[model samples]
Every structure is written in structure tokens, then in C-alpha cells.
Target chain A: MTRILADRAARLLDFLWSGWAGLAALALLFACWQAGHETWGDFILPDPLATLGATWSLAISSESRGLLLLTAQRALAGFTLAAFSGAVIGIIAGYAPAVMRLARPLLTVVLGVPPIAWIVLTMMWFGTSGATVAATILISATPVVFVAAAEGIASRDRGLGTMAEVFRYGALGRFWFIDLRQAAAPLFPALALALGTSFKVAVMAEMLANAGGVGGALARARAMLDVPQALAWVVLAVIALVVVEYGLIRPMQAEIEGWRRAAQPWGVKK
Target chain B: MSAALELHRIGHAYFGQSVLNSIDLQIAPGEVVALVGPSGSGKSTLAHIAAGLVEPREGRVTPGYARHAMIFQEPRLLPWATAAQNIGFALRRAKLPRRLRPARVAEAARLAELEPQDLAKYPVELSGGMRQRVAIARALAVRPDFIFFDEPFTALDVALKRRMQDLVIAAAEEAQFAALFITHDLVEALRIAHRIAVLDLRGRGIAGLRILPGDPGARDEATTFALRQRFLTEDPLFRHIHDVDERRRP
Candidate 1:
């Protein structure tokens, strides 16, 4: 028990330390943004400070915060739907090669149709509502998760399955203990990608459909030619993406794949 | 008493090509039998069949033991789990209470010569030999009445292989369990098995069976070497044991 607690503590520390690197990367992006603002002048690209000021003002307002929350809710709801259904179908297809083969063409077709096209289609179907935004995110994000999960399961070590069989682990036990554990290594990354897609698609759908969200706010800023406000909203959307990815997805990945960290030597940890 | 395992006329083929045919073998309780064959000679297929990992295309496998475990050529340890967790996984099948599982894992780790510190390490953290040790501990933790070894130590260095064979001999003696140990190495078979059954090159059947002198662990190094030498040089049944048929799967 003490060992587990100590390990968890160590991982927490490691994660916190890695945030310094993230901060450095963000600083580099800020430098690039400052250079671009100077090069293009205030008309085309707003200075970093002006955008920050706009971001702070927007953040302090209750209406803009509600809009951000609404967009996050729509994205998360669509992501949850996609993740659950994609994982289930993918796992079943993974165990059955014929099913996987049949799903491959369909996955390609779904992937080939852009998120914008889905937004247009869904806007027509749901008529410019939250459901339209959610449906677009769902269609755009599920393929990535499905493909990753299928590949993960398809490529698992068959030797482990035989070992489980020898030990008399039932079908359910083997699936739970061996198959799912192996599949998780690939599944987590796909989930992260799908989440990013969900947010992007949600915002795109909201903008195209003229729904009320961060995307809708951005549309209004564009109509009024409020460049700094539009950039600020974009920044807010990115911050939300980073929070969901690092805060939720990464921690779950670290917990599931702790053994991978053990495999690395001390110098390789960072 | 009934035999611990009985494989009657076991026949199996992959993709319409027969790899094992009419193979008959039996192991009495507390006996260690080595099935020796060349690469791609269906030794592993037969072991898998007897262990119920594969369904025989044309025969019956009657396992009289209470429970059985297997140690494959690779460690086959769950890379995501710690060594202790891997061993504890097998104890789950034994239906030991959850509270007692740690102690049982520790006991089996000790039996496999795994140290306390090593039990907390994942399989990827351990060396190749240590990973195989974890696999052995996993098998031992189940307290199986029978065990199947499908070339469990072929990947190890010579010294490591000897140490692993000694560990198995010691564990088998202490537990008095029956095992079907499949190997291509005659010395390994001589050192660990009470009886060595030579499998035919073409997978027709068990070519012959030889009962070795003395018990498995009691045999000296010199005795094992000489017996292996005699079997390789003089025994006609072992002529194909070293022969590799290039066409078949290794």
C-alpha cells in the first residue's frame, strides 16, 4: 500500500515537473505571435497584449463564460457518445476479422467526408441547434477511436491469450484482464485525438449553424471586425482543449500505462 | 490410480497439412515426461492439445489432474502488470481468498527464486531470465496438479537454462506434480524428465519412450551429459531430434 502511494506521488511529481516544458513551448508560441503582430501591424494581427486584455475582459463576463461552458458541454457530450460506441463496435470488430474488413470501407467513407460537410448535413437535419453541433462532432470523431481500438485489439499478444486459456480464465475473464488491458495502450491516444476532433467539430458546427457558443461568439466578433476578440475566443477554445487533454486524458493514460514508465531508465523519463 | 494426463491418438493439422498424427502419450501422477522432437515436429502442438489450448482435429485428450498450468517459450507475462500481480493472476483461478493472494504470490515467487524487490517490478523492467522466472512463479502459484512446458527456456543463455531447469526440477519434486516438458535439447530432457518420449520427425506418432535412471533432481551433471551423448550418438529414435526440416514451421 505504501509502495503504491509512493509510486502515485512520484508520478504526480513527474507530471508537475513536465509542466515546465509545456510552459516553455507556450512561451515560444507567444514569441512567434508577438513577431507576427509586429510584422502585420494592428489591422491584420492584434498584438499579444491587446489579445490578452480582450481575453481577460471576455473571461470576466458571465455571458461569454456561459457560451464557453455551453460549447464545452456540447463537445464533451458528443465525445462521450463517440467514445463509448466506437470502443464497443471496434472491440467486437477487432475479434472478428470479417467485421473489421466490412467496417474499414465505411470508416474511410466517414473519414473522407469532412467535418464541414457533416456540419452542413447535420444543420439541414437538426436545423441549427445544439443537436446539430453534437451530431457533427460525433460523426467526425468516432472513426479515429474505432480504428485505434480495432488495431489495438487485433495486434495483441496471442501468447497471453493461450496462457490465460491454460490457466482456465473464461472468455469474459480473458477479455477483461488481458485483451482490454492490451488494447488500452493504443485506445488512450486515439481517445485523445478523438477529443481534440470533438472540440474542433463542435466549434465548426456551432459557427456554421450560427448556434450560441464560443464559435457563435467568434462569428459575432468577425461580423463587427473585432480582431482581438476573435483571437481571444480562439485562445479560450485552445485553453479548454489543453485542459481536457492534459487534465483528463493524460492522467488516465499515465495510470493505465505506468508499467511503460518503469521500462524507461532514469535519464529517459522526461 | 488414473494417469494424470492421457492423449489418445492425438492428430492435428494446420491448413490441411498434418503436423501431428496418432500421437499417444500418458503421464502418471507425480511424473515428469519430456516430449523431445526437432523444430516444427508438432511437439508444442501436442502439448497445446493436451493442455486444452487447442482442439485436436482427430483425437481425445483426457486430463485427470485437478488443475493445470502452462509455461510457454516466451515468458508470456502481462507486460502491464507487476511480477507479483502476474503471479497473483494465476492464484485467482485457484480461488484463493483475495486477502491471502499476496502471501501466495510471495511464496510462489520464492519458489521460482524471485526476490522480494523483483516482485514489485514489471516484466519489462526485468531481464529476459527474470521474466521467465515470473512466468514460472505464475504457473507455480496456481498449485497445479499438472503443468505443460512448451520449450519454456529455449531463449535463455546456457547457464540460465540450467538454472531454470533446476528450478523446475526442484519445484516438481516439492509439489509432486506431473508435467509434459517439451524440448528440442536432449540434455535438457535428460536433466529434467523421468521419461523422455521421442517424437517422430514427420509427426506420425511417438517414435519411442525411454525411462531414464534415478530421479530428475538426483541425477548428476556428468550423468546427464553422458546420457544425452549416448542418446544422440547411438539411439536411432533420436536421429531426427537434431534434424531441422526446412519446409515446416519452427
Candidate 2:
């Protein structure tokens, strides 16, 4: 019973160490915000409590809540479409040299074009709806994903591939064991970037399209010249980005990286 | 026993340069043939052609064996897989059912003398000799009719090398699998081979083939050492290699 109590105490210490570290960092950030509000005055920076009140009020409103959900839906749809299409094309371009040569120049052109330039054309085509926002996000995010997937396939170990061939690994086996494993290391980071970019592009596109979302809420706040309300909406968007990134994408990435680390020299031995 | 592998006047070139020219060889079932020469003497190229990993520019290779596998100079174990998993990879597509796969992997591990703890460890966690043993285990797990060893024990220490040599002889005796072992080490060739072929790089084909009169299984260190000395001094076919090395010495 004493040993069990000791084990529980040890685990509790580890739990406190991990969980409290984040809370401590958040407290430090709030302290800094409070200090800045006092120094900069209400016009430039709102008090922490006042900002929290505004954020809470805006968060509960029907229109603002709907806008947040709509933005999230747009981002998800665009990111999914981009990830799927990019992965397919990337795998083909990575494996086949002839296809890569033809596709590379076109992808470069697409990557180089600004998101704002594409917004005009997308708005004209889709007419300021969810489709227009999703299209903008897709156009912004696909190239980064494509480049990462192609590089991952190209850098795979040829020896392992040859070994796979000797074992008569059929198409599915080859892809699952060799191709996908090789591609995974680079693909995860690209997915993270694409996910983040989709959110930014969706919100930007929504703002310009005057579509119903957080961007539309920002527009209404701007029309009224309510600086604190506008700031609150911007803060909410940032919080959403952080939550999606750290809470969702980051943990998934950490899981993959942990698997990779275990497969590496030091981690496995330890 | 019939010939398990037959190569007739096989020729191969790399980027307009002839690496192997008019090479002819044959290995009977359960026979162990060792090909020895200096570096870049086309021994590896011949082995690669025989393994069907490379295409010959001329002549034909008739593979009478049903299955084949190779152990390269490096262990070439998959870094992502554990030792047991690496060996099991060879059995992944075999007709063996899932229930028997783990047993087969365990048997191969036992044959290779790998510890249970080592079996769960990744390649990077293993020593140089251990990794090579894992490679051998992987090859054996496939239950191939023919196997190729391309300087597979080059990186091992003397004791580890001798142990691996014994393992190969034992495995070959038990399984009756023909092997084409390539190496520059005359001592290694004498310890493992039934017949030794000297590849003549200057002459563009096999210069000499000597069938050793004794069994590899019964040969002791004295006999192996004697054979090694004979290969260096008395073997006319290997004189050129000795002379080249002597000239290159500072």
C-alpha cells in the first residue's frame, strides 16, 4: 500500500509539472496584458477584464456564433479538398519523372500568384458565398502540400524499395510499407502549414466577399467604429486558430513525430 | 543434384564500360561457390546478374531455383523495423498463415542466435555484427532455394566473422540451399566455400576454378589458414591481385 501511494505521488508530480507549466505561461501572458493596458491607456489597449467581458458577450451572440461556425466549416472543407487532391497529384509527380517535369512549372506559377489576386477571380466566379471562401483557401494551401509530398517520395531509401521488390510486395503493400512511410515525415509538416493557411485564407476571403462569418462580424464592428468590439472578434479568431493548431493538428503531429522518434536511434535504445 | 543456377557467357557493362565480360558459372543444389578477387573485378556485378537484380547485356541466366535471396556487404536492415519484424518482412507475402508467421520468425531468430531482447530492438540499436546477423536471419526466413552473399561478413570482427561463417555452413547443410558467396577475403572463402573461383579482372572472365577436396564443415582453423596462404602465394590466378596491392603500398 505504501509502494502504491508512492507511485501515485510520483505520477501526480508529473501531472502537475506538465499541466501547470501551460497555466503558468498563460498567467504570465495575462500579467503582461494587464501591465500594457495600464501603461497604454484605454484608447490604445483595453483593460484585461473589459476585453474578456467583450469577448464573452460577442462569443454568445447568435450572429457572431454562427459566423464562427461558418468560418470553421469553410476552412475544413477547403483544407480537406486541398489535402486530398494535392496528395494524389503529388504521389504521381513524385514517382513519374515525365509527369513531374510537366507539372512542376504549372505548380510554381500557382504558388507564386498572390491569394488576393485569385480572390477577385474566385469572387467573380462563385459570387461571395462559402464556395468563394473555400476556393480561395484551396488555391492558397495546395502548392505547399504538393511540394512536401513530392519531396518525401523522392527522398525514400532505394535499398528498402529494392528489398520490397525482392519480397514481391504488390502495389498496395509497396505503398503502405515503403511509399507511405517514406512520405510521412515531410507530409505532416506540410499538412500543418496547409491547415493554418486554410484558416487565414478563408477568413481573408470571407472579409472581402462580405460573406457571413467572423470576417462579416469584423466588418460590422468596423462600420460602427467600435474598436474594442473589432479587437475582440480578431482576438476570438486568433484563439480559434490557436485552439485548432495546438489542440488538434499539433497533437496529431506529435503522435507521428513520437513514432518517428521511437524508430530513430536514441529513442529506441532509451 | 541438378544445377540450381546456371549462367552462360553473361556480359554486363556500365555506362559504356564493360564490368563483366563473357562470365560463365554454375551452382548445383546445396553447393557453396565462393567468387574472390580484388575490388572492381566484377564479382559483385556477376552476383547481381545471377540474382536477377541486374540485367546482362549478353547471354542468358537460367534460374532453376524457385526462390532466391541476398545478403549484401551492409546489413541493409530496415531502420524502422525491429529485428523480428525485419525477418518477418521476408515472410509477409508468403502463403504461410498469420498464426505460423511468428513461429517462423522465432525459428529464424533462434538459428541466427539472436537474443530475445535483440529481437525487439531496432537495427540502429544493434551493433555492426548483430545487424549483419539480422540480415542473415531475414534471408533464411524466406526459405529460399538459392542465396547470395556479397561480402556479407566484411564488417565483423575475427571471432564474429568465424561464427557467421560457421552459421552459413550449418544453414546450408541443414537447408540444402545453393549459395554464391563473393568476397575479397581469401580466409573467409576457404572457411565457407566448397569450390573457389578467382575472377580475373584483367582477363575479362573467371581465371581459375578450384574445387576444394575437403568438406567446409570439417575444416579447422589450420586447414583454413593453410588454404588462405596457398591462395595468396601459390595460386597463379591471384598473383596479379597480390602484385597490384604490393605496388600500391606506400
Candidate 3:
């Protein structure tokens, strides 16, 4: 019971600190915006306050909310598909040197081809539907996850293998409990990168394919010379990225990797 | 019963470098035998061979006992796991009832003199001595008939090393687990071992053996001092150890 309370208190403290960090980040962003505004004027880079106002307007519009939801679902679906497949395949490849060697060239090829190039092929296959956007997101994001997971698995401590043998952990028990725990921290940067990639690719795919979402709205804003609205949609997409990456992934990370916190010193060393 | 662990004519080499050659040894149940030698005498290789971690290139390693555990040079704890969880990890193969694991883990911690509060903390949170204690507890928790120590106390400070030596002697007394303790430190071998086997640095194997005078755990300071004096003055291996050091001078 006390442990439970301590956990909650730690989480609550993390959230509070994160909240403060977000505000500090926003303050820095505003300074950059102010500088950019002075050089380029409102035509190229609209006032930061104006972009916020435009974002507020989008938040209030029911149509915009639906578009937001659609884009978010596509990005999330792609990220989920990529994260699972990448982690599974990467782990399998990690164990089998032959598989890893074969997959290396394929991974490079897949990652090397730009997402923009894939959008045209996806459009031809999926006919500008949500499928096109999802496919684009997948092609663009999967290699990042795959590469990260493979490295994580490769870098795991071999000493633990002897420990596992001595302790009598079965193959499955070692994989699930020990091997996966060892891989957790290394997988984090990959998962985060894949997430950010999904959002960017989804938006790009939506713009090119003309699927209904904030991306379509962004396309219309671009056509009509509504710079603030275009910037507003970009802000909304970044907000969505932040929401999924932090609100969801980060909390799970805290739970899984909190032991690392104990290693950190609270004060400077003498 | 026969010896808990016996190695007959064990020989091994890496790429023909010949790390160990024609070694034979045995440990009876509840016996503490220390294998001591200079830096490159294959003490760890011998320990590993006895524990079945390494297959001897020649001869046989026979384990008469049902179970065995090892204390490595490093604590080798799972960094992500708490001390209790690390202990529990070792118990996974022991086939204990799921409901009873925590109690067993707690019992192991008590045996190792680990503080209950520290049990919940991860390896990174613990000091070196505490981590080593956790490793000791992990080895003891299995209640093995045989335990192999591969110079596990070398990293510890002098005081902590004595405490760990006492812990080993006490565990051997209470648990009756035969141990093949490996180290290069003559003083440490004398402190904890009933019998000390000296390994030949020149590949002759099993150079000599010495039986200390009294119970290892109960020996007085005077006895230890006298034993050291006798080793330095009379033991040919000890004389060679000193001579080897003298030979390295410019």
C-alpha cells in the first residue's frame, strides 16, 4: 500500500515537472517566433500569437475536430503496426545472424527511399483513401523502429545469459522477463522516433493524397494563401505528436524504467 | 556417497594456448577447498570446469550432487531487478510454489544479512558490497549441494571481505554445501578454507596441498599468524610465489 502511494506521488511529481518543462519550451519557442517574425514579417511566418488564435479556432470547430481525429487515427495505426512488427522481426533477426545479415540490405533500402517517393506508389495502390496515408506512414516509419530494436537486441548484455542458465530460467522465461527488460531502454529512442515519423508521414501523405483530415485543411489553406491557417494546422499536428508521445508513451516509459531513476544522484558530487 | 564434485585429468586450452593441463581435484560434501595460485594459473577456468560451465578438453568432470550454484568475480545481478526479484529469478527453475516465492526470497536475504529495505532497490542503487551480498544470497537461495566461488571477494575491501568470508563459512555450516573456492590470495584461502590446493603456474597442475590447523571460522588471530608464518617459511609454493615476485625486479 505504501509502495502504491509512493508510485503515485512519483508519477504526480513527474507530471508536474513535465508541465513546467512544457511551459519553458513554449517560452523559448515564442522567442524564436519573435525573431523569425522580425526578419520575414507576417507574410512568410505569421505572428506566433496569431497562430495560437488560429489553433484555438480549429479546436472549437466540430469539422476540424473530426479531421483531427481521422489524422490521429491514421498516424497511430501506422505507428502501432510498425512498432509491433519491427520489434518482433527485429528480435528474431537479432537471434539469427543469417536473418540479420540478409535483412540489413533490405532495411537500408526501405529506409533510404524517401517517404515522398512512396506516397505516389501508395496513392496508385490505395486510390487516395486513408489506406494511402497509412501505407505511407508505415513505409516511412518502420525502418526506424526496426533499426532501433535490432540494435537494442544486439547490444544486450551476454553475461546475463550465464546468470539465466545458473538460475534455471527456461528459454521462454528468459526471453519474456530478462531479455525484454534488458531491451527496454534501448527500444525507447526507436519507439519515440517511429512515433514522430508516423505523424510527419501521415501529414505528408494526407496533403499529397487529398484524404480528409487536417492535412486536407492544410492543403486548402495553402491554396487560399491563408498562411495563419496553414501554420495553425502544423501546430495542431505537432500538438497531436506531443500528446501521443508524452501523454501515452512517456508515462509507460516511467513505469517500466523507473529503476534507472535510482541511479541518478540528487546532488553534485563533492 | 562419493565426492559432490570431482574432476579427473581436466585439460583445456584456447587456440592451443594451454590454459590448464591434466588437472584433477575433488570436493567432498560440506568441504571447503580453496584453489589458490598466481594470476595466470587458471583458477577461474578450473572453477568453471568443476561447475560444468566449461567442458574440459580432456578428462571428466562428474557432479554427484543434484544441484549447484556459482558466485562469479562480478556480482552479475540483473541490473533492472530488485534484490528480491534477482533472487526470485534464480528460483524460477527451482519449481517452488508461486505463492511461496516471496517468503523464500526474504529468507535468502536474511541469510545474506541484507537489509529488508534495500531488498526493494535495484542493483544500481546498491553499494558494491551490498550487490555482492545479493549475489551471495542468490547463490545460497537455491540450496545447492555444491557451490563454486570464482574469486568473488577480490573486489571487496578488507573488512567486507572478512565479513563475506564469515558469511560463506556460516552458510556452509548451516547449509552443508560443499564449495570449491577459487582465489589467488593465500591469506583469504587460509581464512576460509579447510584445505588449500595450490595450482602450478607452469602447467604441472596441482602443485601442492595444505591442511590448515583448526576450524576456519573459529580460528584465533594467533593461529592465523602462525599459519602465515609456516606458509612463508616452509611451504614450497609460497616460497615460489615470493620468488616469482623477486624475479620480476629490474
lDDT of 3 by residue, B1-250 (tens): 6998888998988787787888888888888899987776678888877777678889899888888899988999988778898888788889888888899888889889999988888898888999999998998888888888999999999999989988998888888888899987888888888899988875457888888877788887788888988998976777765334424322
Which 10 consecutive positions of candidate 2 chain A have the poorest summed lDDT?
A261-270
Better of 1 and 3 by TM-score: 1
lDDT of 1 by residue, A1-270 (tens): 896798789889888998899899989998999999999999899988999999999889999999999999999999999999899999999999999999999998998998898898999999989999889888988888898889889999988988898888999999999999999999999999999998998888888899989999989999999999999999999888889998899989988987887777762222
lDDT tens readout by residue for model 1, B1-250 = 9999999999999999899999999899999999998888889989988988889999899999998999999999998888899999888778889999998888899899998988878887889999999999999998999999999999999999999999999999998899999999899999999999999888999999999999999999899889888888998988778887656553
lDDT of each: 0.91, 0.82, 0.85
Q: What is the lDDT of residue A179 in candidate 1?
A: 97
User: What are the runs in model 3 whose C-alpha is more than 4 Å off?
Assistant: A34-42, A96-109, A267-270, B202-205, B237-250
Considering the two chains of model 2, state its CAPRI-style docking category.
acceptable
Sort order, TM-score high to low:
1, 3, 2
- Going through the candidates in order, the fraction of native interface contacts each one reproduces equals 0.82, 0.23, 0.51
In candidate 1, residue A138 scores what lDDT?
Answer: 84
With a 3 Å backbone cut-off (N, CA, C), the pairs that clash in candidate 1 are none
Candidate 2 lDDT over B1-250, as tens digits, reads 6689999998888888777878888898888999988876778878888888788998799988988888988887777677898999989876678889989898888888888888877777788989988988898888888999998988888898989999999888887889999998888888898999888854277888988768889888888888778867887776765434423322
DockQ for the candidates, in order: 0.65, 0.37, 0.42
Clashing residue pairs in candidate 2 (N, C-alpha, C atoms within 3 angstroms): none
